[model samples]
Target chain A: MSGRHRLRALGALVVLNGLIPIRTQPFYVVYLLASPLSFLFFISVLSSGAFVPFGVTGGLILTMLSAGTGLQSDMTHYRQDLKFQDIVVASPVEAPTYVTGMALSELVYSTPGLGVFAVIFVVTGLANLQSIAVLVGVLLLVWAFASALAFTLATYLRDVRETFMFSPLISLGLSVLPPVYYPIDRLPHWAQTAALFSPTTYAAQLVQGSVGLYSLSFGHALLDWGALIAITAALFLVAAFKARWKEP
Target chain B: MASAVVAQDLFKVYPGSHSRTPALDGLSLTVPTGGVYGLIGRNGAGKTTFVRIAATQLALTSGSLSVLGHDVAREERKIRERIACVPQESRPLYFLTVEEVVYYYLKMRGLPSVEARRRTREGLEELSLGEYRRRLVSQLSGGLRRRAMCAMVLASDAEMLFLDEPTTGLDPIARREVWAAIRRASREQRTILLTTHYLDEAEALSQRLVLIERGRRILEGTPGELRGRVRYPYRVALQEGVAPEELEPYGRVATVEGGQTLVFAREREARELARWALERNLRVSMGPVSLEDIFLDVVGRSIDEDTPAEDAEPGHDEAKA
Candidate 1:
């Protein structure tokens, strides 16, 4: 397919999965925002508002990561239940374009939830232009990494019900188990080092550093960005080169 | 006529997880460009596998295949660009309205806004789905959903269209509509590769067809040529109350459902048998051998015997069970 057609397919998919659903059933946005907003609410209440900024920052990353991980169920449904994959594979649309389009559609679905987190960021006085730029960068990388990982995993599934088993497990592994909603220094030395293996840890630390909730030297912040970029790039390579497009 | 699709000794074996039988074992045929070319087969006879491979949805285990003069394996992008398919298992996206499903599919195929809308409107009208155009596919009946899928592909300008059992769930009227659409496309000089086990459908629509069994070609020709391949040029079907032994003296006799006895014979003998039944006041129908009889003669079984229940429901009049 030519680049223009690929883009057109991508745009159409986004409108189909993202715009159409939200328009017809806007109430689903509540379900999307529930997890992150609840985490923000409870953490703020439990910590007596001392960690409100941390909660707000983590909510942003969590919301974006959830959108990425959500691709598993979306893609599995499209492939298994809807049989859209066969139709798409036969068309002029390339696999990478299809995958990228699906991933972006999920992100678009979470736009309303992301908007709530943006309001929280401003309310917490953590919305400077520089910090916002860094936070946006961190959220995009996290979303990309999670989306690539989820898309690759979705191809291995034979049934849509299998997604129910895997999507939440992936979300917990990528988001909750890391230091996304808590300061990394709070963990013991070994636990903190182990968390380093997850991309979400770097994303959380970057958000925290930008929002002034956590202290980080320039070198440490640079390392965090480097690690997040590297991990995301590696996952995207797998999604692009190794993901299943044609059946055996 | 040039070949639109050519498969040379194609073999497609599913992984161990799937059925042990090879989906396509050295199955080969050439589908000529323009008009309808039917791939008729019993259930599990590898028709869908061949269409999937030719349409670039699945890969062949061995041998060479090409579509529109491009290799299926090496030139998938080029092949995909020129062909559209309504696969056997395909369904329209339930979330989109029927019109949206067709319109967005065209848009995704890179059609401009005005052209896509025009074709979408026309496709829905052609398939008699215009009334359901604004309804979500989830709300439509299975037959309507199937028609929506057809509308999506039929509206496109692709050179070759792969319609795998496109009218399997449709009623007789809807099936005729689809047949008409296929005919129109053929009149426009588009090659349509259709797969169905409905003998009447294949006979009415396909200019040429191939009958396959267990992933191998048993017959390939025009309907007349295939009917000519049968040794018995006529058939005499005697309704109940006829003893098989009584008809054995005339020709090959086989008992079918509802206690109907089918006797295949040469034209003169068949005429004598029909007259004999008439003298006895027995119910009998005699005619030239049909495609179904030819299929039974070569394969040693009725096609319905092998067709799974879900492939064609017994309740539908068009099922011809």
Candidate 2:
């Protein structure tokens, strides 16, 4: 498929996958909504009301991160179980097109949770219209970055269990280990270095910075924005092109 | 006119396979357009690997392949636009209704919206999947799902089709239904490359057939030509219980079922064998051996004694059983 037609397919798949969770497995919706809220509540109760914004950040990060890196399970089943990849591979649709559509589908699946969180943000007086727009932009970066990494992982790990077995650990590592709940200043030097590479850290920084929860300089925020976009673009290229579409 | 698909010296060695043997070893063939071409092989015979490569679902280790005059390596996109496949292991998306599955696939193939809808309706009706058009595919039975796959392919505007073992798991009725669907698919004289282990299926649908073992074409011909490949032109099958050794005195014998022995021979020899069986108070039936007999003969052993196994086992179904 051409770039334009692929975009069309992506749009259609996003809309189609929106209802997949409802018709096929409604439990996933409850799980996605509930699991993130439980963690957000824990963060809030542990700290003072000062950490409530951190709680919201924690919830948003987990919701998007789980859907993103959890691609290991979704894409693998689509390839090996349902054989959707084999179907699309033979069609005019390009591999990149298929990958992008899948990424969007995951994002689409997470939308309801994102919507619930958005309501929480508005009710708590945590986000204004501008912060919401920035939150959307930053989450897109995280979605692309994590999904691309997961998509690239899928090309080699043919087995679903082997690839997805790391999901809980990945989601935990991306959501908790990063400074999504605590401030980066509190992390030790080595972990601070590690958080630099985690896509979730930049996402939290963007969302936290958007709500004026963290004091930031213009230069650093500008750098974070560039890092978010550039790193996501690079990773997406790696996932879309580095995949071994054909056996050598 | 040029052939629909052509390959020269194709080789596919799967990475890290237990055995060192390549899946496809120097396989080559030409499938002309305008009719169904059957490829028959034993399991692991490279029938699927060959079709997969031709269909652009795989990369060949070494070879030249072209479909509809487009080189497989460089023109895969162009080739993909012209072909559709019902892959052996592929399943329809359970999330979509049967009609939606067909319609979406056709749209993905770049069919115009109206054309996609019209053909989706036509395909569902043609395959009798119309009854379940609005139902999710996951709710359909296996037989109906297979028809849904075929309907999606038939709904497309593709001029070439790759059908790999389309009827492997269907019941007799379902198999016949699938066969009818395939017949309709080939009605417009579209080029169809079919891989099937069922001799009856091949003979019933293919205008021409090729038998490959170990990824190389060995015996190929029209069904009649393949049937005649055996030196014997007729078979004398005992109608009642008789020792196969008893028929050995008349001609070479093979067992078809419990108490039924087939004696392969020329017309006169079969007549003589029938008479000998009758004299022994055993009833016998005589008729032309079928393509199944020819396929079994070729797969089990070389057609000519001088020809070495030349290749590893294709893992023909009976051999595996």
Candidate 3:
């Protein structure tokens, strides 16, 4: 397909899966924001405002990561229940275009929650011009990596029910266990080393470093950005090119 | 006069844990452009597999299949742009209204908004779905949801249309509406490949039909030509209490469900048997041989008996090929 036609398909799919569903009901935004805000509230209460920045930044990262991991259920439902993916495969839209469109729809669905986190981050003086730029870049990478991984996993599922429990477990591993809501240094040396295996650890470090929530050397900050980009690019390559688009 | 789809020595082996099952075994046929071509087969006889392979949604294990004169494996992008499919397993997005479902589907297929809207409106009216255009698909009946799916594809400008059991869930009146819409699409010089279990539907809509059994082509001809190939020219269905031996002298006798006996014979013998049955105050009906009779003769079983449960239920067949 030509670039223009692919763009049209992408735009239409985003509207179909994202905007129309929410617009029709208009109450789903509350559901979208509930998880992240609740986490923020509990974390703030436990720390007595001492770790407000961590809570705010973690809420932002969690919201973005969920957008990608949440795709596991959405895509499995589309492929297994609705069979809409079959309809999409038969169209002029290629596999990468379809995956990207679906990923963007998740981002759109999580926008309201992300906006809430952004407001908190700015009001607490944790976000400046340079920090906001870095945060946006990091969140996009997190979203991209999470979406690609989730989409690849979803394709292997024979049943949609598998995703209901599977996706949240993945979210806990990728986001919760990787220092996304806590400082990496708080873990023992060996535990911190293992956390580096997850892309979210790097994402959290970069955002915290830019916002002055974590003490970091300039060299360390650059390394975090490079690692996050490489991990996201590698996964995106697999999702766009090697992921299964046809049944075996 | 030109072929829209041509498959040569098509074969598909579905990988299983212990033993590989073959779905299509050396199945071959040529579907002519600008007409309704019916693929008639029992459930799991490779009808869905062929449509999926032709539509580029599934790859064949080993075969040479082409759509619109392009290789299916290599030129799938070119083929996809020209063909639209309403897969039997597909359902409309329930969150969207019937109108949005059709309109957005056209847009996703690269139509401009104005053109997509125009075609969506036309398609809805053609299928008698205009009344439910604004209602969510989740609120519609099963038949209406099926109609919504048909409208999504029928509104497109694709040259080759693959409709797999497009009328399976519709009522008689709704089925006729969809058939009319299909006829209109065919009249626009588009090629339609339809797979169906309904014998009457195949006879009514298809210009030519291909009957397959156990993943092989058993017969291929127009409806009349296939009927002509049947050795028996007439069929007499007798009510219960008739012995199989009683009709054996006339022609082939088979006891069907409810103990009803079906006899296939020449018109003279068939008429004689009918008359004898009627004289004895028995219920008997005689008619010209139908496509079903030919199918039973060639495949050695009735289509309804061979249709698997998965084909009737929506969620049973998880595997696509």
Ranking by DockQ: 3, 1, 2
Alpha-carbon deviation at B43 in model 3, angstroms: 1.6
RMSD of each: 4.0, 4.1, 2.5
Per-residue lDDT over A1-248 for candidate 2, one digit per residue giving the tens place of the 0 to 100 score? 66656766676556455555467777665566777888777777888566888888768878887777656677776666666666777777777676777777777668788888888888889888868888888877777788888877776665677665777778777888898876788899998999998777877887888788887677888888987888888887887677756533
Ranking by TM-score: 3, 1, 2
Give me the overall lDDT of model 2.
0.76
What lDDT is reached at residue A219 by model 2?
Answer: 88
lDDT of 1 by residue, A8-77 (tens): 8888989988888876677756667888888888998999999888888888888888887678888887
Tens digits of lDDT, candidate 3, B75-159: 9889988988898868998899999999988888888888999999999999999999999988999899999999889999899
Arrange candidates, best lDDT first: 3, 1, 2
iRMS values for every prediction = 6.0, 4.9, 1.8
TM-scores for chain B, listed for all candidates: 0.92, 0.89, 0.92
**Chain A of model 3 scored by TM-score:** 0.95
C-alpha DockQ of every model = 0.54, 0.42, 0.64
TM-score for every candidate vs. truth? 0.94, 0.91, 0.95
What is the Cα-based lDDT of residue A29 in candidate 2?
59
Better of 1 and 2 by lDDT: 1
Best by lDDT: 3
Indicate whether candidate 1 or candidate 2 has the larger TM-score: 1
